[model samples]
Target chain A: MKNLQIFCVIGSLFVLTACRKRLDSFLFNNDNSIIEYKLDSYGGELALDIPIDYLVPNNDIHLFEYQIEDEGEDLNISAIFVGDLNKISSDTVILYCHGNKDHMDHYWPRQKLLSHLGEQGRFGVLMFDYPGYGLSEGEPTEQNMYESTNGAMKWLKNNGLSDDRLVIYGYSLGSAPATKSVGDQSFVLSPSKLILEAPFASSSVMVQDASILNMPASYFVNTKIENAEQIKKCEVPFYWLHGINDDFLSIESHGRTVYKNHSESWKQKNEVPGANHSDVPTFMGLEVYSDSILSFITK
Target chain B: MVLVVGISACGPAKFVEPLKKFENAIAIDVGGPMVTIPDVASMPIPFSSITYGHGWSDKLTLHGSWYTTAAIFGVAQIGAGATYGVWKSKRQKHGISAMLGFNTAFDVYEKNFKFWPQLDAHYYFKYNYKGEQQEDLLTKNGRKRSNLLYVGVGTWYELEGVKAHGEKQQDIVVPMLNIGHDLNWKKWTLKTEVKLIAPFSSNENIVLDYVSLTGDKGSTGVYLGLIRKF
Candidate 1:
């Protein structure tokens, strides 16, 4: 039995090693050599037409798209600034980081909503795509995403954006970089204002908890994702959001552990009654969610 | 060794109505010598050599083979065999079939892995080798090695995806044992073979073709091929 257990452990390790290599090879090399990206499909030579439906934040809002203040190569990042610029009485900037998959185009609606809060808009909103995402070059990695986000804050500082004007907001998978980028500080802009939406506790936990996979025991997998505990050091306003019916990544994991860590956390969670990952925006009613943002930013 | 078992009554004087009817028939379907498998005439079958075969107790084996590509293949004769089955599959005249058993048979039994620069004329026969190991195969058996020749029609097995090479041959290792349909075509015999251990890289079930005369590798590789009789 001991030998069998040892074998299982060793085999799982090899499997994981192979999987990581496969992922790396797939990302870097043309091992499966064939280009799928159609140059024509991604905004080719067509004359630029500033989207008519482009987001326009309320009176106090000011959108600024700036590059991170970095000299390093390939760390390019751009922001989708939102919120009321004039009413940003608070010096804090909310860097609303997004998840993998898709681009800024799909989230224009959320951009519009952020603009809805006249005074909220004043608290600058910054978000950029990692390499290989949106218009960014190269590919995204957990390590680089953190580096990229840190550079953004550095840019903000060089350009008069301060720690007081820095609030990190990560949604779903983006929560990792958001929580990690916060470093060791509190008050305002430091991972200070964490709003994790339907977050995954860890990749290992997700793999183990998945229903479609032949997941091994939790103890067998070792991935580092200490979100809730790590955030305990955060001495700032933290909020948790999880739809009631989150079919993917279950709200149980994203919600319970997140809210459980706080002695006085300003937490707001619900199943959204009958909502899934995709419909969270509609079920929660944008206006109500938008008001919460206004109150938080103003506060 | 092929075992020829004749079910008959043992007696000097046989009954008027013999239990076994000796059937001797010759079938020659030569319609104006309708084009033989292309490239066959141009193939080279060096030398027709015959080597001695030996057995093993698992440690080793004895292999033997004789080939002739002659002027057709620029090969006068080539004979090689290992104590262990060299790894190969073939068919010859006279209905006798047997796989040089593993651990105790000839090692050079497999025709593949030979690494010979010469090519062999092949007489391929495959049909009802049991199961639906059928059509959807287009191959051209005529390259030297690692190179591609032409593409043909039909198939021996379902391994016809390669752009070149005839099939896997464990010539350097143990020759493969063969078990498949009898693609019996006149005096010229075409055959397919199988190996107990195939390379770990391949995802397809593979087999090799043994042309009685001269033939080379196919562009489709061993996945598919063609053979003709003289």
Candidate 2:
């Protein structure tokens, strides 16, 4: 019996170790630097090289690199400021939370599009990389993401950006922190408006959708971000945009669920008929996409 | 992060089956795979199994068993197999059995199936009584009234069918050492086994490459069951 007990203890430890290792596998990170771009004037024709920066002139945008002290760790955060620095105090700022993928560099084009929303240079767009993404420091976790977002929000507040002049825009993975900030009272100030594009409903819903299985999320993961539950408490005007043919996260399961959960009286949804995930902007065309967002923010 | 926790909690591997069968008896085993270390922790998954055996002749028996675990996160498993036993003792006591079986683990979207072929050999030692030594410990009514202890060794080979994304078919061989006790009282018999299974070959790392965890090279587990003789 004693020998059996000894053996059992050893076995249990082995299983726990394996579980810890398994936990580390969910995060996929890459450290490739953001691509560089150069501009040159040509014979009376202004030609931009990259597809992303077509509308936004290079001189109007500034890239800011700052350090955020989170949980005793100093993490590097990369952000872009679009519009004049002097107008930051007076203009409504859009806190753009981007989706998961390579890093902030990948979403630089989206930031350019957002800068022109509601008339040219009318809104100042602030977009940054979450920790462990882009040139940011530390691995991405729920707690770290929240902390990083809070740090960015605080920096904006300290620089004369107030709650009434702020609009939160979350895309894909960015929706977690965006909804969390409004839903959980994580931030001291509430934004004027909330926008979710291709938002996932929650971790459980995501697992079920991805695996097409009836298994509970708890069996495999402990990350529970219930966007539907959080959106219920949002009091600001809510605008949701989703592609009808999004294969990664289904429109019915995720986008619609979150929209239905919001209790805000002023809530709207735009389901692009032929668009899929990640191509809504290109599919809607710059005119329609920009006009829709401009109208939503102005209204 | 939530992703880390999500990856850590997935997967259930096959457990050792101590090859013990009674002639002309039906047994049900109610237990699950367990891992020991720091403290004993079972898989926390629910499982039940039933086995039946019939004596074909004095030295031969045919048996079959089916086992299944309840679904968690849409994950469930069912296994069924047949065993051919050859008794060495004249009374059909000590024997070796060869088994062929297939099992499947599935979720709502994906299914994984495996074929298992195993060979188990055991020697039973009956209790010594004060007076008469009965080779066949059965009463006039055909009820068993003896206790037996057995030690066995088994080897199993498994080939799995790949169905999940990023998963590939795996072939694994496991060698196991088991000690068991069979208690017989009237129409009811109880069997319990302690098994130590050594991992001969496994592709757990390749299969769970997205996660950092891997299976142990060797592990100890236990199985307890009840058998009814007709």
Candidate 3:
């Protein structure tokens, strides 16, 4: 019995040491600045310019830097709005949530493709860096993710965008906040529609899928991004687009499961063949992907 | 504590059996398994194991153990082994053992099944106290009481089937140090063990999609259990 007591004390110490905030699995990079590129003088050569102007031609790109209070600390958040700012009041805006990766610079091309969806410049696109990604401050966590997303939504709402005209598109890791925003019920207004691209089912499922082992995420991580359960409470039109060949989040286990769990009457799923986790837009071709998104929103 | 950690790896609690020879005895034990996370402290999950042993002769014993835990996930494992006594002295004994086992685990959310086969080889030493050196360490009531310490080196091999990544099987080889203490009184015995398992050989980084399982190289674990002998 005395030996057991000693063992318990030793075990408690191990618990204290092992139980810290585990964030590396979620956030990949800590670099703050966006990558810069210069265009060639020749017109035929396309170059990615700094401040991302070359990506969206004819559209005015407005950069907004804001701060939100999280856990009593101020976090710096960066957002990019494409198309005319005045059009925000009258035109529908798509809130683009990108996947887990480096930062916003890596997603400029995807955002550009979204802006061209349904008639050139017909709809505006809003995208921002989550905390610890790109130029955003603070660590990436479930609570922080919600706070950052809500901050972005509030910013858009304050700047003439209304709930009826707002569309939420979550790609990969961004799907956590996107699905959560609708299911939370605390948000002032729900978006017009929700889009999930190659979205995973939940954090636990992701851990199991990643480790190829039957283990719960709660054992290692506290983040619970339960999209399947959260989507059941959402009533808005849901659009799920997944690469049939997606190796990261399989369509059968994640995307298709979320789509099936959503009881919303207005829901659609597009399984792009020959596309993997990262190259959905490229595989479907920008034109077809844009048109398909345009049709989903307009319908 | 140790049982739980062992379950996390889909294996039996690495408890060192008693070095002293026994004639026609059966024992059962239950305890926790613990595992160490680098930089972070060692964590113990709730796990338990039941073991049965039969002595064939003064120098040979056959044993089987089944372990499981459901604290964070479900894990089930069954193992069978043979222990052979190599040397014995007034206050010391040495033994060698080999075990073969299989385990299956599943998570609540992921709903994926993982199956694995494991093999283990160990060489162990036991040191008995002054009172334990007597031929009969039992009381007038036929109750036995003694303190025994064990130390060992072991090698474990496992082929784990991870169903999440298209049924990919990962090969894990862990060389470990095992230390334990056994206290017996009457028909009840309490056993505690601590094992330190070195990380896998490859740097491929076992990415299960959200977490890396093999990133932490040196893992420390503990197991504690109560056994009943009849």
DockQ of each: 0.01, 0.06, 0.07
What are the Cα lDDT values of the candidates? Answer: 0.37, 0.60, 0.62
Q: What is the Cα-based TM-score of model 3?
A: 0.60
Q: What TM-score do all the candidates reach, one by one?
A: 0.44, 0.57, 0.60
lDDT of 3 by residue, B40-123 (tens): 555554455556666666556667655433322322234566666555564445555554454444333335454545555555
Better of 1 and 2 by TM-score: 2
Q: Which one is best on TM-score?
A: 3
In Å, residue B23's CA in model 3 sits off its true spot by 14
Q: TM-scores of the first chain across all predictions?
A: 0.69, 0.86, 0.86
* Candidate of highest lDDT: 3
lDDT-based ranking, best first? Answer: 3, 2, 1
* Stretches > 4 Å off in candidate 3: A1-30, A33-55, A210-214, B1-230
Candidate 1 displacement at residue B162 in angstroms: 50
**Model 3 chain B poorest 10 in a row by lDDT:** B203-212
The number of clashing residue pairs in model 2 is 16
